[model samples]
Target: MDRHAPSTRCAVITPQLSKRAARAGSDRRSPEARLEEAVGLAAAIDLDVVFKGLVLLSEVKPATYLGSGKVEEIAGIVQAEEVGLVFVDAALSPVQQRNLEKAWSAKVVDRTALILEIFGSRARTKEGTLQVELAHLNYQRSRLVRSWTHLERQRGGFGFLGGPGETQIEADRRQIGERILRIERDLEQVKRTRALHRTSRKRVPYPVAALVGYTNAGKSTLFNRLTRAEVMAQDLLFATLDPTLRAVDLPHGTRVILSDTVGFISELPTQLVAAFRATLEEVIEADVILHVRDISHPDTEAQAADVRDVLTELGVDPEAGGRVVEVWNKIDLLPEDERDRMVNTAARADATDRPTLVSALTGEGADGLLDRIESLITAGRVMLTVTLPAEDGEGLGWLYRIGEVMEREIGEDGLMRASLRILPERVDLVKRRFGAAQVRTEV
Candidate 1:
């Protein structure tokens, strides 16, 4: 979690495992691709590689997570290579991790632990940090068998040591549980505050557009293109951890709040999802959703399903259905013929109005994307006219905040004449504030 500290060298275990099973029947990713993803994730954290090995476990040896022979071989390699750490690409039981670490005289980390460490390191905001810490504590709760001797104990507690301290593991779990409860309470307060803010935004009635996609699928890139603000968009898992909102104008000058949300991933840890529910409220409350897909990835289809699965789990009503715009991003990475074929197929899909192909990095097809967004949010059209006094600058500002002003002119009487295309809700606000006498036209 220390960004400034020197990078640690460790050997990757999953990189060495190869699946002999053909890819004809399984529902999982190919072994090679999964290993590549794990390694790429590890490299992002700046972990140096000393060695990589793969171990296969027999059904009977599942408790150890590796066969005895493989374990002995790993132990030999650790000693011979002077490895400082060993990273397993799969989840391991607490007993297994402890035994492996003791046998090799090196630190041992499983896939879940590695991911938690990454989340802990990447979290920036207070809420984000608290959520990550809560998830980490929940994960560590079940792995409390391993203990450290040096920890201060509570007064009057019974213990064999008879001194003033207890085992570090027990003290750590107790502290973690208390901290987790406090974080939950704080997050509940944050959620309530966010709900109030959402309600205030609703009064203006600007449509909300939420970005949902698999990790590293360029959702952030497209979000920046639409909102014209710089947000972190990197080719790494969960690069954009916090949800960001910005006002964006479509081609017709209609304004809507665009939200860039946390990217989804296959098999996302349950603890993480529960902890970050407050962050994902953007998706649930959105008037329109943009399901961005990386058409260039080999696992694109599965990735799309994964995003939808998470959305469903978040109670976004996959069947009740709000407007969904499919944005196929990273088209520039595909060959021209393949891209054309995808575009044609997308045009024909009955699930959506039409798919928009875009390269978020190079700004290709961004205008078309904006047009589609406008169509989805506006349901084709809106027209309105209102009158505001010259002194009503606050009302004029609200007009600009809500939608595009098509025309503005000062009358001889010193009143401002304004025509705008706004969402229906905004038009209602204008009518209520200025009175029916100010109305000119509505469509």
Candidate 2:
């Protein structure tokens, strides 16, 4: 975190594991683009990126992941630049990580560990902290073998009367096991609490719309633009760790709960995926999911595919009908001609599945985006006009609770008249709960 310190200097090495194999639907992004993303991730935590490069390998080494020659070359850079940390942009086995550290004589971290560090530092809420800690503990548990060699040493003893050294590794394992157990227990409680909250939300009439996309995709900025709440909409990756919710009223006066969740990334850490499952349940239960994209980014399509892959892993079909909305943001950063051309090109695409182009920073095309959301949410609703006695406050209140009241007026004869747009499923309920004769049909 100390940006001024020389010890914070780090080097990034992205290994090209395959020249023929490509990430699903991400062939457009070159390996260099992927390496730039890795460097950005390292910089997210204020790491001073002193050296970075690509290591092309036909095959991965079992022990060090990189060839011996490549390892030696990186080691020279590490020593010359005094890089205290080396970040490899790929998953590393425990043995590989240990061997790399020994060869380079520096602390080594893989992409997963680097992400966990950023999540750990950015988590603010108690639930967010607990989730991040659980993931960190799980990852640390797997690395204990490399970090502690004493665990492998055996103590000579007989039966229960073993030597004191026999207890060392056992105690360490037991301690870690116990901590994992405690964290799991705490997380289970958190999960149950979230479930109960979701259950309670079901009783509310508001439809839930969740915003999900790749890291730094301008989701938070769009969320702030729509909800008028000043959330931490920074340009940094993983800026929003905990899910935030705010009630947003659509153009038709229909209110929906809008949730902003943690952004997705390529090859998300498994520990994080398991630990953050409860947090991601919001996306699973959402009535609508908004897949926001940074249109200005060079790898936007690949990033979208990565986000969809994560969504699929979370049990939501990205291609499901009426389930996901694509929000292409950051058009304000483009030149006037380029922005117009991009918008026109998007318009020429299949309009049915095309994305909504908007600049969250400049508040352009936001109203049309809201109109699309409103139409989607209120697709099956029918507008109605109902009349209630002026003294019948209960009927009026019920109407406001379950439907969008577009207009209201009190007649001189003491009868209150109101116009509303309500869901089809609530029509029978309204007639039965209130007086059937009091309600009238319109539209």
Task: Give the top-scoring candidate (TM-score).
Answer: 2
Instruction: Evaluate model 1: give its TM-score.
Output: 0.84
Give Cα-based local distance difference scores for all models. 0.77, 0.86
Q: In model 2, what are the clashing residue pairs, if there are any?
A: none
Q: Tally clashes: model 2.
A: 0
Query: Candidate 2: what lDDT?
Result: 0.86
**What is the number of residue pairs that collide in model 1?**
0
lDDT by residue for model 2 (1-443), tens = 55566548899999986656444454557889989999989888989899999998877789999999999999999999999999999899988998899999999999999999999888988889988988887887777552344544454567674564556756766787898899889878888888888776665567889999999999899999999998899888898999999999888687889999998988889999998888888999998899999999988888988888899898899987577889889998888898889888878867557789999999998999888888877777888878888888888888887888888999898888889888888888888876678778785
Among all windows of ten consecutive residues in candidate 1, which has the lowest summed lDDT? 146-155
Output the lDDT of residue 430, model 1. Answer: 71
The residue-by-residue lDDT of candidate 1 on 1-443, one tens digit each, is 47698777777886233345222333456556666666766775778777765454324244556777777788888888777878888767777787788777889898777777777777888888888988898887877653321232333356665434445566777988898899899889888988998997876657789999988889998898888899988888878887889998778766789999888876566778788889999898998888899989888877877777888888875444337777899999999899889978987877455668899999999998888777777774467788889889998888776766777899999999888877665666777888978967664
Cα TM-score per model: 0.84, 0.92
Cα TM-score of candidate 2: 0.92
